[model samples]
Target: MKSLLSSRPVLWFLFLFNLAVAVVAPFVVDGAQGVMTAVGMGVVSLGAGISLARDRGRRVSA
Candidate 1:
């Protein structure tokens, strides 16, 4: 798990894939479930992508 998370390509893939899920989940899922699906995936995508970017910047500069 640690090795996987540290891989930039893998993170990029997960970030994009989850972002698509966040966007499409609302239409595909139903009712409140759709909201949950969207929110959950959205959070994960944003968190992973943005945090990775921030960390990268910090690491590169440091």
Candidate 2:
């Protein structure tokens, strides 16, 4: 589970999927809840992507 979540492809997919959802959520769902959920997902995936990039940078520099 941890490895899967940390994978670049997974993070990329999540980020893109969440971004699409955030864009479409308002029309498909009621209130701010759907948009909020997508935003939360985007944040999580964005954080994961940043962490992955940072780790890769350290590896190359070291």
Q: Could you say which candidate leads in lDDT?
A: 1
Q: Which candidate wins on TM-score?
A: 1
- In candidate 2, what are the lDDT values of residues 16-38, reduced to their tens digit? 77667667776787777877876
Clashing pairs in 2: none
Q: Candidate 1's residue-wise lDDT over 1-62, tens digit each?
A: 88878678877887999999999998998999998989998888887898689879999999
lDDT of 1 at 47: 76
Tell me the deviation in Å of residue 29 in model 2: 1.1
Give the lowest summed-lDDT range of ten residues in model 2. 14-23
The parts of candidate 2 lying over 4 Å away from their true place are 52-62
Model 1: runs farther than 4 Å from truth? Answer: none
TM-score of 2: 0.60
